[model samples]
Target: MDEQTFWELVDRTGPDPANLERLADELSDHAAADIRDFADHLARALHALDTPAHYHAVATSGASFLGVRCAAVAAGNRAYRKVLGAPAALATYTGSPGDQLLPVAERAYRTSTRADWQHQTAVSTHTGSNVAAWGTSWLHPHMGTTTVEGLAPQDYMIALRHVALTLDADPAWRSWWRQSGLTACELGIVAEGRLDHLRPSADIRRCADRLRANFTCASPHGGADLSARAVSEVRSMFEVIRQAMSMPGLPPTPPVPTLPADVPEVPVTAKPLAAMPAELEPQGYLTLTQIQEFFG
Candidate 1:
């Protein structure tokens, strides 16, 4: 359905699940294409609210923030506009009141004998940055586009270690990190590793040593155990960092040499490399130079 009609339906439904069955029935009458259009409009509305200011105003980030935005849209067009005008209005959306909208299209589709829902949008709205001019700004007004390279290795680790410990202590914060798909600590570790790999530095090694020592002392036990969620996230983060490092303007991947055909061929046993320390693992990381160029 068109954006105006879709929102009119939402206002009639009154942001409550009680109106869902009736709403689904109404939507069932429309062409199946409109069902997908409803989803696209909903996605755009939700994405519009995915701003740092909105997140800051609601005192939440990630999926919880998305839920609050959903609640705003479920509040209907006028209420959603109110929120866009004043982000602090989001403070009122404490519950998952808008969750009903999430499944409305699917329910409508299931009840009808029409074709399956097809996405007509150019970009997938499931994830990624909001596609609005007022969306996320790369430059922080107070920080004024500071680059990661500005901080010394030791100074950065001290700050990162503090945050890592904080994340370790609070399950909620860790859960948020899990949703974000990477912890600040994980990024810091990867950044340090990738930079050191490109150019070895004694300072980075010393900082890593100090960080491990501090981590040991922070917990009553030797160190906090990494959760399975964190382990999986870190593994993915590492691959992402490695790929980023191989991007344009950074180092190019070396070509593998071809071996000449010889009279005898031998199968070589590869030597196992020593395991990286949990805190110092160099899997996924960002480069300071890359950040410098980006922020500049």
Candidate 2:
């Protein structure tokens, strides 16, 4: 079905999975290709909502936010747009269908046409931050007190540069690398040392390569395309690294570790908003103090 028609069906189906049977019945009439297209659109929509900011706005852990993401899509086009405009508005949604919709679509396709239905997109349906945006490094869990002390400063720099350039090619991968503290140079050194020590004969470029390999090997999520499952799985690998780094063996990282000169300094400041959207405010006339309460 077309995008407009798809959303209309979603709205008519409503957010409650209790009525999944009804939704399946409604979708049963569409062509199998249209049903698959509908699945792809739904997958993309879920992927779009899977962002660090949106995760934070939803006020839930990465795992729990899956349901919330589904709810946003199930709410239909207008509500989805509102959530995009004011991410915090997603906080208002609760108990949204998580992974239920796709299966329902699949079941509908299968039962009606007596044929298999499969998701055919690289877009991820899973919701959650692939990695935490800031704070304690995800690598801290895996490489405990691990530091490569013997590598020459120049050699370490070379490795760091290589890792940076390799991951920097992709914006999302680069963000994941930086946020997990891999860009610290020392972590990259540790990762390389750990990998090389683990497999002496392997031609390992750096730890990032190994991580990327792991992500790739876990690919073709749901046997369709590279789905979000890879990211969710890779996140576990990252968490282990982050934990390992936090153990009490190596000295703490330099308070002022040298950063690459090419890296731009991001100034910390809030961009002032002209006004809060009217929809965000509670219904009824708001007083001056209440207005300050909302803005402040």
Candidate 3:
């Protein structure tokens, strides 16, 4: 089914309390299992890119793991783009909404913490086809060096070059099976759990089937409707899982931590990394002299 139709159905169904309750009960075990698997796979992907040399490896691995169409890192400044290569002018139409640029990154930098941002976009491509993009953005400080006084800009440039190369060469969709499969598993569990509790008069089965079909159709193109429903369902299931794992008669489970609605830009001031001369090893690290002499 098309995305518009799928979302129309979701809007029509709303969030029926009876359906949610049933879904929670039915999907508890499966949700738990899926979360565990997701965590494990995420951990492994991170481990593989733990080194500075492997930053692009990390991005590629994450994109593959998350089943997104494409993944990129965007720096706080318009001049800086992430994981792709070098600072450049922003794409004319690519500015994020003001509210979308919250202070999440600033807070993380201040605390030297890591944070993730989740976002979705719908845009008409040059070909006039609608393309949807949704994914997470992780912002954290570069752990290598806080001080680059003795370092030349070439050193930094070379480092960025390596990062770009890594991203370019690595697989774009690394963990599709684990992440997407887990999502499907969770959906199934929710559908089954609520099956019995739905009243004889209720069309819960039909609703679930519609959601499933819509979800499958939307996966390929990142349909807005399916994305919204998936986010809602996953969030609801997460809460259920928490409550089920909690002590009996305890207070309600806490909500999942959400990415900031706004990510404020944090200024990064650094001497631009200088480019190494053509004769030297292209990928090798540059020296302080090389940076000074080249740019001087």
Candidate 4:
């Protein structure tokens, strides 16, 4: 369907909860099962929203279940898009031709306290265009010391939008790598490290070789082309190393010196240990009383 038609349906119909439930009920047993599975997977995804590790896990799994080619989750504001290496156009929700549904999804994410609201879409086979599908789910903030209020709702919305877009583009293998906490640059560095470590394992070595090649081809400026699944795996591996390196008791780094090369050095001198008049001293040491008496 065209974006205009899809949006017109949304505007006219709004979100009919009862109608959605009925649609779910009308699905064939297998399709219904898949939908249920998708919902469950989404819940898990919400739970992992805040954690880098969990974010990678949920993003990867959600893409796989939904059959998307690539997916990403981001936190913070628009600055994160640059960090993730997304195209400048993709970073903002401009309500453009390809992104009409984004504003709706962003609103849902902002207001919904729970992580139950979700939106889906499909890619047109003929046009290679993304068409909006329906989605319902809540937003789940990452767990830890901070609460949901601590996070930027826009960031969550962007992540959701990415997942939906990937599902539309490639439902066969969900793409979750885009939502990972690690930026593309960070992923590349981690991948480089892994290649070095797994040199002994032929299978791993081969995989690493492919990853290295892909990394080179993508170029830091170009976009990542690997499946979302591969991105997730590489990101997960990177996280493991990051955590290990962050552990306590690691040797501290030495401080860098800041002294100037042109500064002059000062000289040092030592003074005599004892004080005695040379005139009072004879070939041998003179007793103090004898010397004093002679002087007197």
For this target, which candidate reaches the highest TM-score against the unseen true structure? 1
lDDT of 4 by residue, 1-296 (tens): 23333223333432333333332332222232344343333233222222222223233232221111112211122232332343322223212121112233323332433344454422211111211211111111111111111221222222322432233233221223233232221111111112222221111111221211111101111253324433343334334533433522312211211222211222111111123578763222222232222212
The C-alpha lDDT values of all candidates are 0.46, 0.47, 0.25, 0.25
* Predicted structure with the largest lDDT when compared to the true one: 2
Give TM-scores for every candidate, taking all chains together and pairing residue i with residue i: 0.49, 0.46, 0.17, 0.19
Predicted structure 2: clash tally: 21
lDDT of 2 at 113: 90
Q: List model 2 lDDT by residue over 1-296, tens digit each.
A: 77788888888887777876898888888888878878877877777776645655643322346667777877778999898777678777754544577676788789779976555664654432233332222231111111232221232333233222222333354454554444432222222233223331111113562331111111121243221322333344344444544422222221221232223222111212235577784222222232222212
What value does the lDDT take at residue 31 in candidate 4?
33
Predictions: Cα RMSD each: 17.3, 22.2, 28.3, 27.3
For model 3, the run of ten residues with the poorest summed lDDT = 211-220
Candidate 4 overall Cα lDDT vs. reference?
Answer: 0.25
lDDT of 2 at 167: 27
Which stretches in model 2 have alpha-carbon errors above 4 Å?
A: 59-63, 127-296
The predicted structure with the larger TM-score, 1 or 4, is 1
Residues 1-296, model 1: lDDT tens digits: 78898898889988776887888999888877787788778777877776545755554322255567778888878889999989788877856556667777877876675556555553333322453532222211101111122322332223332233322334344343343233232122322222333442111111231211000011111242323323333334333533433422212111211111111221111111234588896423233343222212
